[model samples]
Target: MALVHLKNAGITDPTKIDESKTKAVRLASEKVGKDLYRQIYDITFIEKNGPRIEVITSSEASAQECSMSGVDVFVVSRRLGGP
Candidate 1:
């Protein structure tokens, strides 16, 4: 399984996430379940300025989940790290 990092630009509001994303992840899990690992959220700092929220998932489907949420995604890259 490959780790996917999804970065997006939007206001840091927890309540504004699309419900379809949550559903997508749930449905995707039923198919490619075990491959999907953990998910982490962070904020990126550009030029010592404000932060942009990022969601790092463990698979392409997971990245799609974030995209389905209607957030303006910037990048989705594979994660390189130890388990």
Candidate 2:
């Protein structure tokens, strides 16, 4: 399993994020990495109007990580070069 970063692309209010919830998400990601050095990526927060995150992994896993992080993911249709 690989780790992927997910950005918020349509978040109207990032400040509305629950601190504890956010922390939990981070912790979970960390735990996942502890067992397996999954390729981890950081999700950068952009403008509130256009919340977007870029993940460096398979789209399927990316979506799963996003769901676990409590973030809605809108993956752009494209193919990544790799095996």
Candidate 3:
């Protein structure tokens, strides 16, 4: 998967940001199931003025699950040399 730095995303308007969040949630719900979304809430983050997401998880499976569901995630575990 490719990683995108937040600053270069080019979205700054509040309405568009909210729209993106809504679309992300909808896509995730359809692709990953609404029930499972609650299960992974600890690893997900949606912001208003800043980076829209900041997903950090220790589980590769969970990260991949979000990725397949169209949510960007970052896996940081001891196995990957993360503290």
Top-lDDT candidate index: 3
The TM-score values for the models, in the order shown, are: 0.20, 0.21, 0.18
List pairs with backbone clashes in candidate 2.
Answer: 7-53, 8-51, 8-52, 9-50, 9-51, 9-52
Distance from true location, Cα of 37 in model 1, Å: 2.0
lDDT order of candidates, best first?
3, 2, 1
Q: How accurate is candidate 1 locally (lDDT)?
A: 0.31
Q: Superposing every Cα of model 1 onto the true structure, what RMSD results?
A: 12.6
- Model 2 alpha-carbon drift over 4 Å, by segment: 1-8, 23-36, 39-83
lDDT score at residue 62, model 3, on the 0-100 scale: 42
In the range 1-83, model 3's lDDT, one tens digit per residue, is 21232334532333434444532122222223433442232232345655544334221224336443343545322234546
The stretch of ten residues in a row with the least summed lDDT in candidate 3 is 22-31
The best-first sequence of candidates by TM-score reads 2, 1, 3
Worst 10 residues of 2 by lDDT: 19-28
Each prediction's Cα lDDT score? Answer: 0.31, 0.32, 0.35
In candidate 3 the C-alpha lDDT for residue 59 amounts to 17
Select the stronger candidate by TM-score from 1 and 2: 2
Better of 1 and 3 by lDDT: 3
* Stronger candidate by lDDT (1 vs 2): 2
